[model samples]
Target: MAQMIVRNIEDSVKTGLKARASLHGWSMEEEVRHILREAVNQPPPARTKLGSRISGRFAGAGLLEPLPELHAQTIEPMVLGE
Candidate 1:
């Protein structure tokens, strides 16, 4: 495996990276490698409608609760005047 060196990173950026690495249970170097891999390795997101994407995400999650039936007798039809 090849190695890469990064220099001149700001102190705040380094601190943030360290904190993020700790949160994810990784060393700073491992976090950097993970970030770089994610940046370069992801396949392009599918070119699909937003609805399709959303549906695909929750496809097998679970059944939603059924809505209660509304009182049809109390509803009035809309009256349009010309």
Candidate 2:
């Protein structure tokens, strides 16, 4: 078993931890240990690409047709009215 000393924690944070420990029926130390264990044991989140994320957000929007690629199209600059 390893022991660690954390310093300079804000009074509010300490109070919050104490409140959480009381709510869970655990000592503050036990609650902190449980929190640390859970934090370290979780698997890393999968990294999704921006385009894939965008597609996923609109997946249920009923957009069945694939949009045309405009990579080869040229854009003309808009002329200012006199």
Question: Which regions of candidate 1 fall more than 4 Å away from where they truly are?
Answer: 43-82
Report, for every candidate in turn, its global Cα lDDT versus the true structure. Answer: 0.89, 0.95
Tens digits of per-residue lDDT for model 1 on 8-67?
Answer: 999999999999999999899999999999989999876999978887898778858744
Q: Give per-model TM-scores.
A: 0.51, 0.68
Among these predictions, the greatest lDDT belongs to 2
Candidate 2's displacement at residue 63, Å, is 1.8
Q: Write the per-residue lDDT of candidate 2 for residues 1-79, one digit (tens) a residue.
A: 8899999999999999999999999999999998999999999899999999999999989988998889978999998
Question: Clashing residue pairs, candidate 2?
Answer: none
lDDT for position 36 in model 1 = 94
